[model samples]
Target: MKPKCISKLKITGTKRILQISLPSRKCKSIRVSPLESRLNTGCANSPKNSSSPLRNEQNNQKFISRYIARVLAKPEFQNKKRPIKTAATHRRTNSDGSKEPLSARNNKLSGGKSSCKNSDSDEKTIKKGLGIPNPDIQKTICRELSKKKLYKTNDTDEIIREKLIEAITLSFKTTNSAPNTSIDFYKLGKQIGNGAFGKVSLAQNRLTGHKVAIKIIDKSFIKDERTRRKIFQEVFIMKKLNHRNIIRLLEVFESNKNVMIVLEYAGGGDLLQIIKARGRLTEDECRGIFYQLIEAVKACHNMGIIHRDIKLDNILLTSDYTDIKLCDFGVSRFAKAGEKVDEQCGTPAYLAPEIIADLGYEPFYVDIWSMGVLLYAMLSASVPFKAKNLHDLHKLILRGKYDVPEYFSAEASDLLNKMLNPVPHMRISLEDMKLHAWYNGFVPENILDLSFNVTRQNEILSKMMSYGFPRDYVIQSLNLKDVNHASATYSLLDLESSYNYT
Candidate 1:
């Protein structure tokens, strides 16, 4: 025979003991005998081996309590108060002083005036009324109810409604602790690319159904604590940068054996692949791509960041090939004005003469020199300072021995010469490069304006969304800025802070 359903349950007194109300035999559709009903309602039968229905129900409750206890043990819920119990009685006396049934008592609990003043206190009272073992356990139980999409006041069941409120509030305590769960949230696809650091694969978010690139790095390859710290620093820096011409870091997941970084999927591949396919680009085409690259570099500098390794391979193209994103900050560094970096990092073909000199060099100057080499490669399909060995390459770079192809425009050669000057102090600054005669008519005047440029506005919006801001709210914030006065001179942090987004 099926067990009779519970009619009502409530918590009573300061200790918050659970009180249950069993169905009355006088009610309609009584399936069991009055003795059976009374036996089932009171307690389980005392049998050594026999299974009783009431015993099963008690076991289920205990199972739930154990699960809740496990969830409560999480550090986030440690200091939370125990679920408050409502001062609800088993029965209410009517106008004639007659005690109402379990159904009427449930109605009173569900729809009657709440004794608490605020929603927080009401939630506490409901949790107490449910007789949850502790606050943490109560929070976990509520989250489960919320995931099931339970409605508090709308649900006819009082027990379910109380559980829903508890869950909705518990979800507000979001944590940034390294996730201990499996990577089941992402549906990994076929491998798309690979590098010395990691392999990139296409993956889809199981929740949002959005496609992204996942870079999975092997922890064993990191070798030292310094390298591990750099990996974390890269993640931290990328999270702060929000630019249209820079790849977005969507999320990071780390495990004992590997680290996974989710990024914007650039389907058109890197500029190197495109260059290899097309051999060389026309001057106009080169001008457009070069303009975007400079703008990206300018943005990075404004934020006090230096992309130590700036090469054709580090620049990725969007699917349509109309724009490029500067990525791979593995060797990048944060620099203050006038600070010098001594590291001899970056690809050999693109390393600046100052970097090859083994002397401390300003990172910004090294970046400028690298951009010159990149520009040369884009127009000529070959690196300017090529040699048979590192020794020969260093000698050639030190001598500043690079011949500009005659086919290149005079304006391009002039800018390249200024940028590739062997003396770091003589290298062209980013501000000067923007106003060069070559880019005067080719690039837009407001290309670097974050507020006026639609691409930049969209990039800022995308970043704010990643930070959990609503889309409408981000749009409203962006629209409030004065477009004409906002310049690329402002750092991303400065612009974002101006709008009070943090």
Candidate 2:
């Protein structure tokens, strides 16, 4: 107030803060150290001989400030650049394919929803994963079935494929034609899994005797509006998603008390189950599963959808375990190009750093990060980052701390790093993924989805019309992405025959 108090400071390259303060009127000086007054007033004993309270206070403050500044400034300490503390002897290969010591790379770095509806706790997810050392008798049976089926999945098996489609079509048409149907069309079987909302059971199409997994959700238990919208959103997304690697939503049935979602059954169980049943997967085996996953994710991205959750639990195995089906779209959302969403929702471990940062995140990039986590799990049989609690988990994620198993191939490790990059703008994309060396010579199969294939639209329409579903109604449902009996009927045919993977 007296002279518009001015102060300035210039820190040296050695990286220590210089004492700084503005002058006060009572001080009658142009400048002063913040500690100057304390030095003057509390020097009861001679400074040279003093072990006084004032001296102790001054030392304490100085020590604390310096410690904090160093922690905040040092590259190695700042933001916890190196997560897992190890001796300098350990080395990790850099992204550029060069090896560097843990100490040499001194720095680096920079950067939940519901139980029943696909937001299981980290504890539960971990417990369910990497715990089973061997597959039970049932998984072994499915494995055998899978190998047998794989041998039959060839061009010569066209008749078999047609028969399968016919079976699916007959189930849809016969069950839908039944009078006053809700869940009556399905004969619910054994409970496969259960949660607060309800149980997921093995069910049969009463008309065609096809086995499916029906998720029974009690409406009253899902009391919140957000949870209800999540249900709608899940249906909205899964209906539009018709990829060879995605679990198909056969149909939805609603009544006064519950909503039953009939989905394609994966008898071999989820990826987590298979991982537990057999120790970790070999790189080649993991690559096969991962390749299908990449295709599945591309399909989702092409449809402008973001599957926020992409962990082990949601990856189901086909009856023969020949392939995987990416399921659980309960947390998926539609995000236009470059749009950022602020809502934070997903499993704790699979969440991208930006989502944990509480900043708006590009939904598509978030999927890539989660995919990286998935690959890590498949390779090592453990999550990349883990902590005792949510808060610590967030800390680990923000620091970009994770160990690459010694067994990983250079290509596999490099691809994983690109996908898990902390910077959103720098993250590897699905298109770029096709060029990555890890996928070299790994030709993608005849990928297909439930999209409108103009070339074959007329032909398929004629075929469906032959089946008695009015051409106009079928066309409208497919175009509108409606989740109902017609859409289900279309899927049985489209996923089996129509809709190119392009």
Candidate 3:
């Protein structure tokens, strides 16, 4: 029989609380309360160490709890231990029909090695049984573990590493805290990435089992009313905007200092990653990606939301390279019908001439100008307006005088010139962009039959992994001193002239 939250089971001679991880794999072991107690503390009492059975059991439980905490907290362990709960712990029975030793399970987990054999328990067991007797201890352990689960760890470097390992072991000791597939709604899995604000985790929806990304933002960094309001506005904007080409926001969860924003996880990572791996994106691929992006931007314009920060970094790719999703709405603004925005905020490299001039202009035009910059970056794997200092960059942007590279096609050049027009009134509108020659026949004839070659995608991903865009485009363009190459003489003008427009 499987463990339940309130179920009583006899393990050896003790009647213990058995809780199964509901809706999880059957082969997974159910943690008794005794085990939970052990994992909470670092020490586990072994047969060699414990003089009496009662004392031994207590030590073992404590050790196990600490061990669990260590394992669950690790990056690698987080991947192995999922949060889903299932009714069956389909323990493989030997011909003799005896239960398998814990070592066997531990070996499997450690890939055939007993790495954590010796441990001390949090509480001394009364006898050789898997049971919980003291209600007070049980309640304490349960509350603490749940609290830890709820609170995202904000430990330092060394502490994070140690705690992760302990957490993994603790996870298996009790099933009460197991993430319910039905209740959790989303299959919360491993931590994919982290940033200054918080982390991005991979999650799967229980209903569809589709992998998604969950970004948990730390509340500590969001200190002021400006930030709180910004977060709320972002959530509101994401809730309203819906498009295939845009990074779809599924849900927003506000818990403590952790604000979890659930989104469609892009397995292929971000365009910036792709570009970093590859010196430059292929012309055809760039065209297709830009075409989709413009359409998405047009949709945003139609919805009255201005994605102020449009760049390669904000674009994420699907597992297959066929689709790209625009993400990171931190600087996005919602304009009321017939209203325009003058707030100047966005990435410096992608800011429009009007923004540089500090002149009030329709925010949508700023988006269009940024789109042009994005296109240039996609095609050449470098920003068009590059300089050493912000002052020079601002001057260049105000002039809007970067020469289009010779590698650019006629159609791309024309589109670039039109979209990047310095005058806000002259920039292409969302309506006109859709009707442009470059995008005229780009719409899908059938949504489901979109062409996506897996082989090509693999090649692209592989190439991206090894090579992409240049990292120091801004630094290099300005001819700044490379910290490592103080004595090396490099000519910036010569390098620029090498790729001069005909």
Question: How many clashes does each candidate structure show, in the order listed?
Answer: 5, 3, 68
Ordered list by lDDT, greatest first: 2, 1, 3
Instruction: Name the top TM-score candidate.
Output: 2
Across 68-177, the per-residue lDDT of candidate 1 in tens digits comes to: 44443444333432221111121110100101111101112344542212222233433332222332543444334323444433544445434333332343344311
Q: What TM-score does each of the candidates earn? A: 0.56, 0.60, 0.52
lDDT, each prediction: 0.51, 0.54, 0.47
Q: Find the candidate with the highest lDDT and give its number.
A: 2
Q: Name the regions of candidate 1 deviating beyond 4 angstroms.
A: 1-182, 443-502
What's the true lDDT of residue 465 in model 1?
Answer: 43
Q: Model 2 — which ten-residue stretch has the worst lDDT?
A: 38-47
Model 1 residue-pair collision total: 5
Provide the global lDDT of candidate 3 against the true structure: 0.47
Off by over 4 Å in 3: 1-190, 206-208, 337-340, 439-443, 449-502
